[model samples]
Target: MKKLSVSILGTGFVGLCSAVCFAHRGIKVIASTHNEEKANLINQGIAPFYEVELEEILKEVVNRNDGNFKCLVGRKQAILDTDISMIIVGTPMGEDKRIDLTLMEKAAKEIGEVLRMKENYHLTVVRSTVIPGTTRNLVGDTIQKISGKELGKDFGLCMQPEFLAEGRSIKDTFYPDRIVIGEFDKKSGDILQELYESFYGDHLKKAPILRINLESAELVKYGNNCLLATKISYANEFANLAELVPGVDVVQVMKGVGLDYRICERFLGAGVGFGGSCFPKDINAIKAFAQSKGYDPRLLNAVLAINDDQAIHIVDLAENTLNNLSNKKIALLGLAFKPGTDDMRQAPSIRIINELKRRNASNIIGYDPKAKESAREVLGNKIQYANNIEELLKDADCAIITTEWDEFKILKPSKFIRLMKNPFVIDGRRIFSFEEFDKELTFRAIGRVALK
Candidate 1:
């Protein structure tokens, strides 16, 4: 059996992680970027972005001196060297709420350019999230124009959607729940599947795979994310209703609902809303795609609308609780969209902080274990940043636990009582124990109303 060599385009979460992890698994990975600086950083085993457990593996992979993985600026050379080339570039959303394939188009052009020079039938995998028909029509046609070769005979195409969470990407990559390979043909699927077989040898037994056609794979990514977003919005809607009645906890309601065997409790937690890289972007893209195809997706529209209001709902809880935000020292417990990663792309904290500023909150400060620096990019000097959880709560009038980071989860009620000028707590993630927190001070939370 010949060894598997893979080349990846782009150096985002998927591209970089896939390169390092595949190399860590002893597969040769030639990762390339248009940016010389980014390529340099990867070659030096430094990750330009923050992801948990990436640097360790990357460093190990680089230090092996095995040339298993190394980033290059020459993407064409990178493709020439590898048997399978995966396009993992960004497909950003435009102001029109549609998928912008500028990066993908560039990658496809590069792939076609490479194929024109190459002899062997290469496998081109689209790992980036794209709309249906993008692989065959946009990417394939472009490749054919440049290379002057037929699809199945000259080179193969596969749409392999990546399901990686920002924080837990390495673990997710190593222990994927499932594998999906959307193939242009059976040969494409077979080649990609064989590569996975080599990559995950024994672990491949644990992971199930879906070998489907191109559009299904693309839509599967959107469907998976949109449904999760809907679940979050659904829980938020229930949370809103729960807030109307005295002492009604939507946490309890969700627990009951989740017990119905069909709906297992996963993304059902009612929080400020869903954010970060994927959920918000995918929903908007797919919704826009559906609209362009002459079908209005009203449910997704509602999902986004509900998500937008959630941050405001949290701020509303704070304002109503304190009576006036004119002079309250607001402390935000978490700044990142979620725990572990320092990505604040569409974090709810941004919306929450903006709302706090609008209401004339005296002094707003925030603390997150990892996201402080990343938060600064979006938040700038809008809010003072606390070095630790204690400093965040110290002399604060009230604090809201926005993202459920593990650090905030351990803080006892006594800590809040001792640190704050007046201990008013809003558990945005329902992480605090109502039994314990209520016994100490005025406690409010999302999904449940405070008892009078």
Candidate 2:
């Protein structure tokens, strides 16, 4: 049997991870990018974004391929010559809350032009988060119109949505709960399934591959993200309730809720709502899609509203605690949204800093191991960037942990408490306990009892 050729467009998070995952399973990957600089980064075994295991995986694939199936910049001859091309380009949200499919549209046109220059039957799979009917409308129809080829006869079409977390992208790709494929027909489904033949079988024996219509697959991506967003909002709502009630902690409430079989305890922590590439974008897309279909989407709108409030709750606490915040040096422990990756797209840190700046809060200092550069870009001139934890907390009036980077978890309280001018720490992520801190420092944690 001849090996199937695969090309992944867009060198961003989704594209890079997908390329390496396929290559790890022995598929020939032509990871395509428009810029020569990004392509050079990939060729040199460096991932464009900060993912935990992506560098290792990318380097392994490139070394194994011996430069044959490596990252290629531009619409190179090799990418156009490949048998299968997957579109993982970004589809950003426009001002109107609709998905901006311009990137995907341009990539599809290029792929179609490549198809026009070829005779073999080619299959194009879209893995980006797009609105329903995008593959059929934006990609499939565009390719058909451009290449002058009949759909499902001269060529094939499918949508395979990617489910990857920012930091845990590598593991999530290969070991996903299940792989869903929306194909035009069973033949198209089978051919696409063959690409993942190596990864599936043993662990997911029963229903490793799920077959659905193209729109269903697109809907599945949105549905999953919306549900996750709901979980965060639900937890935050409970945390607000807990705050109002005396002696009730949302941490205990979540612990009780998680003990139930249905809840299972993920995204239940009530600190500053979710911020990253997936949750915000996906939830907004769901709202836009729902509104377009004539639905009110009130529930999703509330979810976002609650999240916005959640982001500011910490700053509110800080302001309420200190009467005047000007000229007071405040320390922020984490910057990335949930850590592990250097992506700070919608990080709650941005919200907290902006709010603080508005109220003329003291000097805001931030320190994060991985997300300093990205955070710096978002927080330019608004705050000072600290080199280390000690520097961040030096003579600080209060400390807040927005992102739960693991390194912050193990820091000795004795060390943190000693450096502060006034020992008031807001455990926004519920990272520390009373046992860690002395009686002098007042600890204010989310959904937990405060100790002075």
Candidate 3:
């Protein structure tokens, strides 16, 4: 059987991951991006952003797959050259908190223009997450209007949302828990199913495939993220209650709660709350979406509220410990939202740092294994950047562990004692144990009693 030729119409995290994953499965992948610099870097096998194993896989596909994968700057050429085009562009939040589908609409129009000149049948898939009816009503209508092509006759459309976390996107893409295909017609659905089967046949036996309507497919993506966000918020709520009760450990309590089969221990760990690209934006988008349809999303609104409060609580913990933060040299141990990637979108660290500045902290130093450069873009000269963990801790009055990176987890307690003027640590992710630190060191973690 001839392999399918695919074009990914964006070079963000999702588009890059999809391109590499498809190319690894022997499909020819053309990754399209409007940024020439990004395209040049990708062509050289370097990913623009940090994702685990993305660079290595991209190198394998670009250099060793006999030209199976290539990154280009224009969407029209890539669309014309491929049998399938997947729209993975950004859907940033608009002013009204709705998903701004400007990039998605542009990509669809470009694909539509390309399809007008071609005689061969092509499949257009929406891999970006949008509101429920977006795939059919917005993307499909735009493409059809621009190309003069009739849906289910001249071309086919499908909604297949990606369920990838930022840090582990490559693993998630190659081994998704489920594959969803929302088809406009049977022919389009069958073709997409076959393509997925060719790539994920072995995994399908373990992970089920869902064939549903376009709206359901779109809803599935938002539903999954919102539920996970809800779990994190729920745990944080418990953590807040646990603080009032001395000697109560939220971790052990949640562990017992998760032993129940109904609530497994996935996103149950309480920390500085959920922050990243997906949770904050998706929850807001969904809430706005519901309101637009004359519906109220109370639970989702509470989830956002809990998350916002959690970020503020971390700053409260720091201020209470130091007594006065006006001239304190504070050390922030992590910058990225979570470990393993350089993505700092809505990271708890950002809120924590901003609050520290507002409280007149004299010096705020930050360190991240991979996200320092990315953090610089968001934080700029507002805070000090550290070369290493030791440097971040040097002469610091207190330290806060925001991200639970492996490097931060393995640090010896003596390092804190030796470097900091006062070894006061506020652990957001609970990466350390109370008993591990020396008597001179002060340690506090969320959902547990502080140790002095």
Candidate 4:
């Protein structure tokens, strides 16, 4: 079970993170990526992107020089060295908001070329977020065509979806809730399951490993993500309703709703909307995929409508509060989609800024404790960047809490009152207390009707 080494293709969040975590566990890991610069950074013990609790473990794993982990650029040799190859490539959402399998197909071809020449039977696992039937239909066909290998006898294939949160990827990898393996056959599933059983020795006791057909495994990731997104959208819908009824807070409403034995309180936070790489993209793909198959997902459509409207609603809230955004210096508290990550893929802040720009608001400043560089990449000179919270709030006519950073939550009302020219605040994240902020400044929030 523990005899085999692993090769991960791609340097995306799941790829590099899984490679490093596996190596840290003393398993031999050879990862391949096209990005030479990112490879250099990874080999030097530096993570190219920011993720919580990644760097410290990564530095130790790299410095140990135990030959457990090494990232290379476009090498079939890496695949040759490892017994298992995990294609962790990106399945990006195209402009049409559908899951694009270009990268997935390319990765399969790369592995197929490697497997063609190899004498030893190797296992290939697709660990990327993909639509149903992708592993069995698209990936399996391409690999078999290139390698001239029999499906179950020549080599192995598995689709193991990773359920990793961006900020807590390391922790999730080490102690995941469950392991879902969609295998080509019993042989393939057994090999992949053995690896996990070996690596996560005692974790199997708590987290059951589910072995299923490839299509079911692929859809599980989408179902999990879509349901979570729906919960977020559902909470948001209630949060908005709470605003209409005075003396009602969604926080209290959800806390009670969460007390039920079935409904957990994980994604029920009333906020601007769900963003980042997973929720929006996954939900959209599954919805589009379902519609293409001639079954329209009414719930998902509603979820998307509610989420898309959230950003516009926030901008509308700001306009109503400030009477007009023209000639006003607006400050965005956080730029990243969420805290402990620099991921800003579909961040509501971008939508809000675009709406503000449409309304002719030119002076916009933003600050994020950890996402400044990535923010700059996405928002290149679109707005002034502040060195800190005080810097962003300083001389600003209105402040919008776009992200709920820990540092931003600790901020007192007096701080914004002292810093801003107008001291007008909009709580998009609902981090600050409505009672405190509404008492101190001309404050407006997404949820919770004003008590004054």
Candidate 5:
């Protein structure tokens, strides 16, 4: 009998969100974090980061524990109490663009040590995104070396990749497009299915139970992310070319292309390029994995090169319009890669901001509906933060829109023109219609005809 005590290793966005989901569903949860400060915050039912409805969910779980849900701080209590553990630690990319397994190694070593002192059959499930064979090579090896116990006996392992978007994490969790389980064997697969069964209830019997080998499962995550990244890159490539072609509006072109049944459009918006944590990290991991296998990752290299170029290229256009950013106050309209969440992990805004710095842009006014705090953390005091859109663009020479927040789309271009010193708008994202702008304001968009 698998006791329903669940311990989550790593309480970042995915970890905490998963913990809340399980706990709310009457599953006892002990969420752990490496940092003491983070653990305490989570224990108090306060969300550590900016996520939509996370605080409300955490509060509900913590306040109404009723014996089913609980938040356990520190490593000792977490490992000691639970028989089923889910590792949700991050696997950051290294300087060489390889998957940095440092956090994963540490978590595995700790789990191995915990296993060494335990007698129960521990089910270790990895919910982190990793390369193929990472579990067998790194995690499995670490457990064997540290626990001094043979695999398939003392403990069972499986890979459960996360597929949550930053903003809609909770929604995606409860209603994931599909649930993927990568197990070492049928036994491990069955164990995971049982654990996640309650979430699906009667639908469990009908849900796709893709029981594949560990490596295939791992590759699935990277493959999914890379494909999405590829779509964005392809879109941007066309968007850039559209500018040279007369009478070509990339937006319309994409809309026409997307109408086809084959290419259902989602990441096809050709803006300032794709950003955020998953796409960039997973793409690099794939590239590294291919390089390790002695395969030339030329496509991956191009994908990254194009994204970087597009992001930096926006700044170049902005600089040209404004005649140098140095000592020129520039208002950057959007900060987060996408709207609906305050997560700025690997945002294209980083490249744009860095470029601004390089060109000695004296001041930058920035605003995002959700990602202000995260943007500040990444940008520091270099750029000024505006709590509102009007405040951000007010008194600025020119404004650049990096992120395509829905708010920006509805915002009147004349209002931005009214607020700025130069009244010039560089639409990194073609969020506004060219016809909407007046003749005086300079409006430029990527891969589209510039409206004078």
Candidate 6:
């Protein structure tokens, strides 16, 4: 069997992951990017961002196969050279809170221009998280206008949304729960299905392949994220209620709630609300998109409202515990939105730190194993960056664990007791056991009663 060739546009998380995963499966992959530096680095077997096991797989694929994996500076040649082209460009949030499709449109225009020069049939898939009607209207119209090609006749178009999380992208790509292909026509859908089967069919025995319309495919991405975001917010709400009632533990309550067959325990863990690349943006975009279509997304709006308030609530816990935040040396244990990845976009730590600053905290020190560099980009000297956890907690009045990194979980309670002047700990992620701490130490956690 002749191996399928694929071109991935935009060398960000999704694109690069897809390229390497496909190449690992013995398919020829052309990773297309506008950034020459990024392309050069990938070509040399270097990954631009930190993803678990991504660099090793990328290096293995690049070295094992002679020309199976390649990174190029532009999309034109890559489009002409490959059998399939996947658009994975960044769709940043606009000022109005809707998804800004500027990068997606630019990639579409470029793909259309390149398609004009090629004669063979090719499949163009939108793998980015876009609003519904975009694949059929904006992307299809732009490509058809420039290439003079008709969808389902001269070429193929499909919406294959990616579901890989930031930290576990490689694992998710290699073993996805399912594969969704939303096509303009039967032929396009069939082609994409065959390609995916070639790579993942044997590995994912039980994972279903869903074939649906373009609009449904686009909406599925938003639907999946919104539901997860709702779950997190719901858990937080329950935690708040549990805190008021005596002898109630949110973790134990949630554990029993999750044991029910209907609701499995996945995103049920309560913490400072979710904040990464997807959940917050997708919820806001869908809300804005729904409003534009003359429908009010009340549930989604409430979810956003709850999340925004949750971040502030963490700061309030710290302030109330200390009685005054002014000139207090506080320590933030985690900076990333979650564990495993360095991405800090919309991280709850950002809001919590900013709130502490507003309350006149004298010195806010932060430390994260992987996110320090990325956090520095957003924080920019506003707070002190600690070389290690000890440095962050030393001489601090209060300590908050924002992200649940493994290193933070193994810390001895004695460290916090001996290092801090006041020895107060606020556990945002419920990382420590309340009973483990000594009576002299002050301990507080979200969804649990404060212990002294």
lDDT of 5 by residue, 141-193 (tens): 89888999877887888998888998888887777767889887777777788
**Local accuracy by lDDT, each model:** 0.91, 0.83, 0.89, 0.89, 0.83, 0.89
Worst 10-residue lDDT window for candidate 5 reads 67-76
Which of the numbered candidates is closest to the native, going by highest lDDT? 1
- Per residue, candidate 1 scores C-alpha lDDT tens digits across 1-452 of 88879999989889999999999989999999989998898888898888999999999999998989899996889999999999999998788878899999999999999899999999999999999999988898899899888899999999999999889999999999899999999999999999998888888778988999999999999988999899999999999999899978999999999888899988899989999878888898998889888999999999999999998898888888788998889999998899988889888998899888888885999998988888988888899999998888998888998899988899898899999999999999999888789888989888887676
lDDT of 4 by residue, 1-452 (tens): 24779999998889988998899888899989999998999999899999998888889899999999899999698999999999999888999999999999998998888889998889999999999989988888888999998778878999999999988899999999999999999999999988887789998999999999999999999999988898889999998899999988998898899888699888888778988998888988998899989999999999989998888888888888788888999999999999989998898888888888999899999999888999899989888889988789888999999999899998888998898898888898888888888898888887787777
Q: What is the lDDT, from 0 to 100, of the residue 222 in candidate 5?
A: 86
Clashing pairs in model 1, backbone N/Cα/C closer than 3 A: none
Estimate the TM-score of every prediction: 0.97, 0.96, 0.98, 0.98, 0.95, 0.98
Q: What is candidate 1's local distance difference test score?
A: 0.91
lDDT (Cα) of model 4: 0.89
Model 3 Cα lDDT, one tens digit per residue, 1-452? 88779999998999999999999888888999989999999998888999999999988887884878899889888988888999999898888878899998899889889988988899999999999989898889988998998889988999998898888999998899999898988888898998888989899997788999899999998999999999999999999999888888899889999999999988999999888888888999999999988999999999999988887888888888898998889999899999989999989999888888888886999999999999999999989999998789999999999999999899877889999999888889988876675254788788887633
Alpha-carbon runs more than 4 Å astray in model 1: none
**Candidate 3, run of 10 with poorest lDDT:** 433-442
lDDT of 2 by residue, 280-313 (tens): 8888887888888899888899889999897678
Please report, as a residue range, the 10-residue window in candidate 1 with the lowest summed lDDT: 443-452
Off by over 4 Å in 5: 1-3, 202-207, 438-440
